[model samples]
Target: MNYTLHQLQVFVKVVQTQSITKAAEELFLTQPGVSIQLKNFQDQFDIPLTEVIGRQLYVTDFGKEIAELANEILDKVQAIDYRTAAFKGILSGRLKISSASTGKYVMPYFLSDFLKEHPGVDLTIDVTNKSKVIQSLENNEVDFGLVSVLPDRLKVDEELLVVNKLYLVGNKDHMPKTAKETKEIFNQVPMIYREQGSATRLIMESFFERTKIKVKKKMELTSNEAVKQAVIAGLGYSIMPLIGIRNEIYNGELQIVPVAGFPIMSDWRLIWLKNKKLSPLAVNYLEYVRTHKADIINKSFSWIDLAQKAHKH
Candidate 1:
């Protein structure tokens, strides 16, 4: 059987996305073109690699094995490109990253400087929840995964990028101004919660467990923005990352409820699979983050201090 690396690349993306249309879009090729390449690649082996059921694509068992091998081949090719670019004293390549939904607020600030400095590097970011982000890391689909909570089950390397502090927030008119008052009002007030599998939800649950406080959960929403809007409309209270609610807090649409043991802190980490070999681009990004973590943290969270001051006045 004979196939080009480009065909393998296309096939791998098709499997990753589970949709030919999405794969085509990412590859910047027409759907029919991607389909033709996939057909040709499969014909060489005369085996079914994928099938569609109920409008959803599913990779065959054999396809899973092929995808694994394809990933290995692609990694080696990327390594060669990285090494060549390094020898030429230039850094250039696509850098794929996955981050938890909440990281949507934080990662861009950290990534902005890197993108500006390494204009040759192409960047792709997948904003998803914690579970999907970890799945991408485990599959070696991304160079890095940004999350506040590290999975205990995955063997991975992690770098602490910053501290993520969560604040209990609600509509200004509904929120109590002091810790003791908020504690007394907790069980009586309806609480809007992030959906299951959210890092913020997990952290909030852990906080509740530790404090022995029970919440009257009224609604579950999929995104931070949704939860924020719900709280703004006076539906309920929510524990949200300080990064996500700074603007709302500054504008007085939301106020941090001074709940006991407020600002539950967690470490925001950049993670990658431990045994996976890093390409030069990945290595450079890791080093850049490590060397400038302090600056990244200060720049990212300086608004928190300002927001607090604004809230006081």
Candidate 2:
């Protein structure tokens, strides 16, 4: 029927306290006003809401069911109001993000700068393997992700962020002199590799497949940092994003080896659900990345080159 929210509100309040006077006090209305509103509510529904049993109000089964619906409607209204205010830029909110392990090295720098500019926005960053990041995005657990290798199915929409070249990185002392030397060293050394579902591992694998050569792996780890550490400790060499290993290579802790017949690289993407609703703030963040996409890629590779030179004897 045609019932107003005010009537539902009064009915809910009276049912909650089981006392007209108490409901009126809570609602800042006189007892008679609450009683009148409750009567109008019941009249609209063609049902009796409560019966007086020795001055105590007891709700009917129908009344309880209707009150449940009322509560749900009120909750939805409140949520709408909150979202409306956020859209107006009056309320601040947090955006949850997930990213592949390699992103941990560069994504945070970009986020920190963004947060500095938008003090009203909050952020939560989850750094994990590429597979987990994609899984989280698909499960609707995170608003966005920075991923290395995306699914071929293209179930999500992605913004091109950067182009990254893969490098066979290792400790400076164990650096290879040429592509042949690199392959020989790879065959001899204990090669640390990323776990399955890793974009870095996939890139390396595809390169090997193209060249008709298989490089044996000595260890498999989930953490990109762990792989970097192992390589620095002379355990083995591994493929990694140039941006990620810049510092170590520049500091003479790691060396970059060019593989023969392989110059494989992948595009970094900022991804989100194709069908999910994006908040205004989330859209703003994506736009910011698009504006600086080229700069970000150039900066990443620039560091790689400088780091490679520093590692030279």
The lDDT leader among the candidates is 1
Off by over 4 Å in 1: 52-58, 92-98, 120-145, 149-160, 172-180, 251-253, 258-260, 271-283, 298-300
Residues 1-313, model 2: lDDT tens digits: 8788898899899989999999999999999999998888888766777888998899999999999999889767766765766787764456789988888876875566668777667678998888888888878988898887887654899887666667777787976555453455566556788899888888878877776766777889887888989998988888778778777866889876755533357777788989889987788888878776667657554565565465343
Clashing pairs in 1: none
TM-score of each: 0.78, 0.66
Per residue, candidate 1 scores C-alpha lDDT tens digits across 156-274 of: 99998777878888898876544453566687678899888899999989988888888898999999999999999999999999888877887899988766676788888899999
Report the lDDT of model 2 for residue 255. 70
Query: What lDDT score belongs to each candidate, Candidate 1 first?
Result: 0.87, 0.78
Q: For model 1, state the Cα shift of residue 281 in Å.
A: 4.8
Q: Cα lDDT for residue 222, model 2?
A: 80
Question: C-alpha displacement of 207 in model 2, angstroms?
Answer: 1.8
